[model samples]
Target: MPDQIADPSDLRGDCAQCFGLCCVALPFARSTDFALDKPAGKPCPNLRGDHRCGIHADLREKGFTGCTVYDCFGAGQKVSQVTFGGQDWRTGTKEHARQMLDVFPVVRQLHELLWYLNEALGLSAARPVHADLRRALERTERLTRQTPQELAALDVAAHRQEVNVLLLRTSELARAGVAGKGGKGGKGGGKDRRGADLIGARLKGADLRGASLRGAYLIGADLTGADLRGADLIGADLRGADLTDADLTGAFFLTQPQLTAARGSAGTKLPESVTRPVHWTAGS
Candidate 1:
């Protein structure tokens, strides 16, 4: 398995292969993440009559960068072709429409797992379980190709539990490699935070021990309950990020500017020189 996240640029997006499922099947709130509030089973306003984003060329201008970041990873095509036999929601009965909508989210989860599994397989450090990871990846890919009925009826939680066991092994292998060689990460030229936008990232319960997060943008990220023990957070932007219930015991080199940029609750533990954010006190 690979020691890092696979570059997401490798993913190909072809909505023609999909049934416009993401635009119809997913729910979103009117927040910074989404431009509008949409219910499940309803097509987004940006979705064109021809099953494409009407604002595709100007998503950033219209504040739909979150939509741009989302990648279905070909599961949309597999579900539309293999499961429903190329049937679109426009051609389906009410029951079929409901079924397709339900199955869409399931296939999306499977695709996300595929992403993680693919990443795990590229790590030379996970040699002990490289064979297992590859096998699991192939198996998951096959499951992703199942029909709508199979996908809709799948016990995804159980599959996720099974996959998580393998991911744990992968994490252990990679983290062990990081801990070796005196805790220096393999990336040459040290930590590169250039143009890194980590808004709303799930860093909760993350083991960021000894990590160099220099100049990284961590705005609105959830670091609640994170283990930041011994991390180097110099020059990182932490604006609007939540550190409530986080444990920063023994963390190192966290700058004042970084601390000032984040939000926290009273329960958040802190480094000696920095106090909690003002919002934390106001909210408390």
Candidate 2:
């Protein structure tokens, strides 16, 4: 997992190597996640030919809260410089464009994992696997820098499986202290929501799976790449929370209202059957 304590200079707005693929590679409906409906692979209306967001200066006001939380972990540069050899999708050869398209999602997934893996390494509570986590981070970082051919042809699922094994280990180590019997975070404490104002907390790559976060205030929290599967988020205020690449496959009580109230980048994955929330419209 990559660290959430990102260098201010390395954040999304400062990245230069990527051609703003997230604005195009991902699909967006006119909802809380995007300002308009954009099919996957089609360039976003706000995306400039120069690979920048045309509305980068006022994305939030324009109903692009989800874009505000996205980060590529410098993978965009690697893809541009090393993989596709500096070819932007707009002017690249058809094969080059296809390669870029194919690898964008894969690199996005790896970069998400890298973000969490780095965070796990820095956690004092996860000391037992700190060294292992560091090694895993390095490994994932190398994987993320692969050339386009290598990345496009790679088995991303298998890579994810390999990285997940380490992430699971890291989670077990970090949460070990909180998981003891009659220890700190038991069922009784889990229900206590007093003063849990975790607004804008950097919870990237956190394993909040199955936790009862009822009524928790999670506004602007960077939950990118976090493992929130099966967590109870009922009544939690998720306004401005970044769910890019975060997994909520089995999360409970996360309704459209909650999603609308909160912000999710294009990389955010929701359960099937629920269309993208409808707050990301132009005036939303």
Candidate 3:
């Protein structure tokens, strides 16, 4: 195994080093999340000639809340600088631009896997599977470096399934140590809520310590003051969920985009992996 691990910073979005690929490659419908409809492969009207968002600072205020919460997991810079050799999409041919756009989403998925793998490797309780996590991380990193054609043809979903197995193991190993630690409702730790339909559920002040919330639909759920320490939150949809004062310290697999989509307050306790969303304290 390598002496040094991949820096977590490299797995985060750095729009300055990118050509605004997310602004061009992603599609959004005119809903509460977005101000207008946008088709895939088309540049967002707010994208400037220099590939920066014109209304970036006021995205939410402009009804483009979807844009504010979207994260490419550093795939934009990887695609722009490493994959395309820093080629500007605007200066390229139509076909060249299309190819870049096509490969962006694929690499984004791979990068996301890398993020999860990296986090898993950091868990001391998951040390037993650290070697497996490292190997998976390395493999995913290599895939992100593949050519545009190769990436476009890659079966990312299949690869993600493979990585998820190791992540699930890591979660079990880590959460095992916290088992039996009851939450606010006095529910036992390590709750199995995987893929649960928690949408609009009244879970305020609920105890969810060491819970497996993978792929759970938490849209518009009331999670205010909920205890979620050491929970596995991978793939959980937190869109419009209220998390005011929620105690999520030590939560694993919780990504920034998920936190950004939820409503929180300064009183909300969070894990070190994700920062508190600026919008959470905007008016306070």
Candidate 4:
């Protein structure tokens, strides 16, 4: 075993080092997520001159709950320091602002891949492909460090597809250990519910370890105390899911956005990739 710690800087979001690109570049529609409608390239109304959210302390309380859960996987800093050399849009020209906004999402996609690849490395069962995963991580990291033009013109969707192949294999390797360990995962007619509309489904305390929940719409589902260890939750809509005490110790590909959207208490066991949402508390 390696004595070095597994912490990777690019995999975690450091809002302090960011230039608040997310608050300025990303557009938001007036919906359940945001309180107002803002077009692309326009800064949010609550953004301060210093790139700090003026309403950061009360985002969820004031109807901008979506902002609270958004993570750029350190893309903001990558664009701030490397792509644009730490120049803030506030001090840049119109073209610079436009270019920064354009490159933000591209770098974000690459950083997200880095996050997944880092997680895959820690899974013991995925050892067979760990070397490949490391290579992909390095390639993706290099892509994130490229100049603004190079990043903007990147074929991001194609790269995402290639990375997805590796992630799928990792999921299979990890979940195979749950074959008959009292888990109903990938069994019991537990049909692949990828992107299914299971909103508000009464799945409380369900035995779903190692199940594939990729892109499943579990919005507002009653999954309190469910066992989700080793489940594949990549792209799954966990917004509003009741995971009060759910065991997600080994859940794969679960992102900050999905967890932010859901309501989970302190008892909800999460993987190291994401942080516990502040809104999750007793009786939440």
Q: What is the number of backbone collisions in each predicted candidate, taken in the order shown?
A: 5, 19, 0, 1
lDDT of 1 by residue, 1-284 (tens): 13333333323345778888888999989876588899998989888777788998787579775575565766677677767888888787989889888987887777667766665666565678877777777777778777667877889999877987786566555444233123555341122333467778998876665455545688889898776654445446776778887777644335444665566777788865355654366333
For each candidate in the order shown, give its overall lDDT on alpha carbons.
0.67, 0.64, 0.88, 0.83
| All candidates: TM-score | 0.62, 0.60, 0.94, 0.92
User: What lDDT would candidate 2 get against the real structure?
Assistant: 0.64
Best by TM-score: 3
Best-first order by lDDT: 3, 4, 1, 2
Worst 10 residues of 2 by lDDT: 180-189
At residue 76, give the lDDT of candidate 1: 75
Model 4 RMSD vs true structure: 2.5
Q: Judging by TM-score, tell me the better candidate of 2 and 3.
A: 3
Stretches of candidate 1 exceeding 4 Å from the true structure: 1-11, 180-284
Candidate 2 C-alpha lDDT tens digits along 1-284: 23333332331223477777777778888887677888888888887777887888898799987676555655566566666777788887778777887898887677656655655555555577677767777776677777777887778898777776665555444434332122334332223332379999998887765555667899899888877664546557888787777877755435454676665656666754133554453212
Worst 10 residues of 4 by lDDT: 182-191
Q: Write the per-residue lDDT of candidate 3 for residues 1-284, one digit (tens) a residue.
A: 23227788999999999999999999989999999999999999999999999998999899999889989999999999999999998999988899999999999999999889988888887888898888999999999999988999999999999998899888888777465245322132477788999999999898888888889999999998898888889999999899988899889999999999999999999988899987788222
